[model samples]
Target: MKKYLVLLVVPMLFALGCKEKKTETQPDQIMVTEKPKLPETVLDSLKNHPPEGMVWIPGGEFMQGAVPQDKQAMDHEKPQHPVKVDGFFMDITEVTNAEFAKFVKETGYVTVAERAIDWEEMKKQLPEGTQKPADSILQPGSLRFKKTKSSVPNLYDFSQWWEWSIGTNWKHPQGPDSNLDGKENFPVVHVCYEDALAYCQWANRRLPTEAEWEYAARGKQKNTIYFWGDDRSKLAQEANTWEGEFPVYNTKVDGFEGTAPVKSYPSNGFGLYDMAGNVWEFTQDWYNVDYYKELAAKNTIAMNPQGASQAYNPQNPYLQEKIIKGGSFLCSDSYCSSFRVSARMGTSPDSSAEHVGFRTVADPEMIME
Candidate 1:
């Protein structure tokens, strides 16, 4: 449930064939395409998800984040405060290929990754007269994670977890060698922020807000060290995480070394599964560092709190990353203990990875009405 904070976007220069610098189009590019409207019957199909993957957490009060002056806590997680939310339902499981395929088939919709790059849009990123059709879905370009040697000083190399691979998309992960074949049960990966948003639209739902997501993930707790309370030893048995060494060797101690199928473990009090370990879920918020400070300063629990300005999924620079919660099977105690409910990470709206996935939540206003 933790979110990565430093996933903000950075400016870069790209010249197609020209020598001058050019700025890329904004991340939220407007692209028009035809899509099938959902019929009432089709829209009703999602009414029933397996109970094992989801649970209802009645809305109320809970202390959010670690207590100040606690022996173990981060600055961002400080100033533990009370948060109140209305009732809502969340998927018991991370969205799977089967579910996403159902949405695609019913809507005749293609994902952002599935769409060919707009040459016109790409042109805007290039110096004048330097634009050309460089790549397409006909060809491929995706954010891929690659392990590399220490390019920076040996002590400051966080480059071990990511690489920008061209063909490593949702359909063909790990480059050409990968296929969706038998992995349909695995949570869909390589999706950008817009891709997850599109899926929610098709499903008649929306991404949870960071507060809502944390409230649900925590089930019901007040300043507990974790979703299950403060005990890392207990975590070893309940969830999937990296074991053995740091990055290179995964012992699969939790019986899973990579992405595991949804509902691979017991559900939380709210009956939601995979909220702690699996692929991280996206939240509908813009991230900001002083966001909490701003919230507290306004004498408000949250003043329309969103995420930051720009966050990049290490795999892709074209998209701006947002907040993604709940670490994956790849997270480790030594590297990323983000499996806790308050843990966090950031990702680009247009970038996808083998370890990123999401679920849907109903609009509370509509439900209440």
Candidate 2:
């Protein structure tokens, strides 16, 4: 069960065509742009020199879904399939708060979390006679995790720990009073898909397609439960997932109660850090629960699968979602065991949360002369 309350509000805002402005004086306005394509010459230079915090992932075919015997696997991750992905350069670590701050400071980008909700737009998602939420409740904010008082048997009800905290955004992750003081190196949270896209635009990069994200996360490891391999003992040493009971308490076995600094953990085979945990990263693909089945039905290796053209989740039919790869620090064996390389999740493209952030990718096509 993904959070739906936030999702319900996201599509409405997007439907209204509200854009974030990108001028130095107007930091609160939305800015929108078409996806960028890099020039061949620039791409060639990138291949040789590579970007400062990136690793080259060689192109290849690999198992792209849940392993045959993964009991924890969900139906959406099943029917393992082969996917072929081209080589590309991927961020070595999740984009840090410091990095996102630089983009915001330079571009004056206003993240979705910072914009006030439009009641008129929101009403479109409701029934004919439904009443609107109070103006105060519609204030600009983002979802943040709040530890539950006790263990929750129904892990599906994520509302137990996730709350829409008013005034919560990238600058104030927890609330209005909280700031990114010493956590500059921590992966920036409370960023929606648009915010990530804006950052990518500023950096001259793009979000990885779902196939690329999985391929890079696998890091050349064939059919392993995790990027490091199938060993559970190594999880604590290699990632920042929840160690104790989820929602209620965290044992901090991985030495992090919330998010650890980027690269605090060991890197995967391709030298990518925090690939398993830290934050759920956004991908450039619309999510469809049965998309894998559709691909498997093809019976041939999917050549650079770009993901579904439209989003669909049977559980929440109205909300549009995009595929988000990797799990977050909140992942727990008892709850969301999504740290596994093949695990998949979806959320509204305009929904931002404390457990979500993203990294960028540069495709090989860009370098092809």
Candidate 3:
């Protein structure tokens, strides 16, 4: 009996020793953690191209518009409330011809104006009773810059900056005669809202939301007035806005009468340029004066909500315009006072003007889970 018990104990001990030896031979395996892979476009944007005239805004919340309850406010600015935004990257300057060209070459996408309009589609868009202009006169085309005025009564209307020219498009800005030769540095004009969208889509970017745009234009400061703060007095050297007597004679005090090169002036606190003046920028949101009230009520954070489901403003009888911000080189205190951080305007999506241009925005996080 004693010998059998000894044998059993010996074997158990041997097995325990073998297990311990095996454990010693293989220590716990180490796991290496890694970050999630980002989309290729997002990674590319991070690589150094050097922002020409732009800034990185770590977006957050801020009071939007003015509350009528507040002593200092306007009818349009009333019912102010907090608006939150996600972080985004915005161009410091309006998109130049050189930048748009890069997008075109990479994507081979034609802008809306560049495409020949389908007569059937045009007819469908027109009001039921409206007569189609004869083919001889019905030159289906897009907006173009006109140094000379047309007989249209609304041509000089600061709001109406477009002229329908047959050959007009981004490449033929003033018509086929005009080219991108010397105007590479100039803000690319004659681009409709759809044109801007196509470029953004190809670049894997988007137009800034109106809320995001205002937040960025305001820079780091909160509740302060202008992008450069509350000072409206025309300082000797400051932002590129209308100076001296507007329209009739711009003193060119700001080194430019028309559009200046991006970053020609000092940058705002967030390092963005031309936030106040240069050319009015396109925003993703549609335009409606009461739209702000709706957004405030709903606390919407949608990147792009179709504006107003329906038109409310009589100024836009046909409701063709969407929101545009930051005023333009043509903005004046005597006329249109949209140079302020909070000011906004809208125009026809199909229209373009010398005062209108756009910048692109990149998503901080391009992908979603």
Candidate 4:
């Protein structure tokens, strides 16, 4: 979904949303296997009880990055390497609207989408010689999926599905007209990386590092495609994603057309919900397309690997991005099949979109401090 949450520092401000960078890679059907159960943990006798609504994930070493058999794997996901992480507590599900509202109520924090766009600051992330747009286009807004009437020219143009809508934010997911009326239980969307970090600061929690996110997503199932193992057959019934033609119609086979409520599906081996699909969860890693290769070259297990030191996206070198794990409702086999555990994307630290959200984690040491 790297492109699904794509943040193009477009000279055209009217357009928001991302288009997957076209790839020759094809996804062949993978082998089927049973979803694993959570391994026994020492939580029962531990003094560090998981923070409320959080689960303690006892860390262990595992082969990180994509396996060769993952036909859907991208260049960035390749060159499997070794990694280990410290055990920590993670949010059982993506941060829900209700939970985020509590943060907003207490901190009175306004998300990036709610703020007026600044041309002076925005141009810094754009290409030189790019003309500044009109005042109306610089108003508060966020990206929302706008379904096409029928198949478009091709999927390469992400603008076909993602639309930059004014008055869109966490409170108003779709646009100014939409509200969180009955959707408080749904995972909060239209939250950018900066917005997520703000919430983390307020809550005294932090976003999981890229290594931790992938490790927890695996749920003890190593060398497998998803947290539920490599059973691609059961993916539709297990994760909330587009069941029909993407950017056009959704069959709603997953019981919801858009974002489904948390716990709507079975949890992963670590008792984590929506680890596969829902909304893209932000991680602490800076975006580096070759970070995996760099780690693999070490020939030694990366202990608590904190992402790349600097942000780099050859596609969009102007804007800085952070790693985003888990695919969103827009994900599909025909499109960006990023629901797999290893699937990762990068989006602007300041951009917000409908299909993007985040969760939080806490290091055990932080709790003691």
Give the alpha carbon lDDT tens digit for every residue of 1-369 in model 3.
011111122223222322111001122211112224556576556533434344567757787774233333445564566666656668877899898888888888776656655556654433344444446534534544333233334323432343556666667766767787877887887677888998877766778867778888878867766766566675325566777544455677778877777777787787787887888899866555666676567654433333344334444343345678887776666656677777777666765555778988875454231
Query: Model 1 — TM-score against the truth?
Result: 0.74
**Candidate 1, which ten residues in sequence have the lowest lDDT sum?**
1-10
The TM-scores of all predictions, comma-separated, are 0.74, 0.87, 0.73, 0.88
The order of the candidates by lDDT, greatest first, is: 2, 4, 3, 1
TM-score comparison, 2 vs 4, better candidate: 4
Each prediction's RMSD to truth: 8.3, 7.6, 24.4, 7.6
Candidate 4, residues 83-103, lDDT tens digits: the string is 877778899999999999999
Q: Return the clash pairs for model 4, or none.
A: none
Model 2: weakest 10-residue lDDT segment is 22-31
Question: 3 or 4: which has the higher TM-score?
Answer: 4
Once fitted onto the true fold, the runs of candidate 3 whose alpha carbons sit more than 4 angstroms away are: 1-54, 66-74, 134-137, 140-162, 244-247, 297-311, 367-369
Error of 3 at 35 (Å): 19
Q: Model 2, residue 127: what's the lDDT?
A: 34
Choose 2 or 3, whichever is better by TM-score: 2
Clashing pairs in 2: 19-30, 20-29, 20-30, 20-31, 21-29, 21-30
lDDT of 1 by residue, 2-51 (tens): 01111211112221123321223234311112223334453344334323
**What's the CA RMSD of model 2 in angstroms?**
7.6
- Give me the overall lDDT of model 4: 0.79
Off by over 4 Å in 2: 1-46, 126-130, 364-369
How does candidate 3 score on lDDT? 0.62
Off by over 4 Å in 4: 1-48
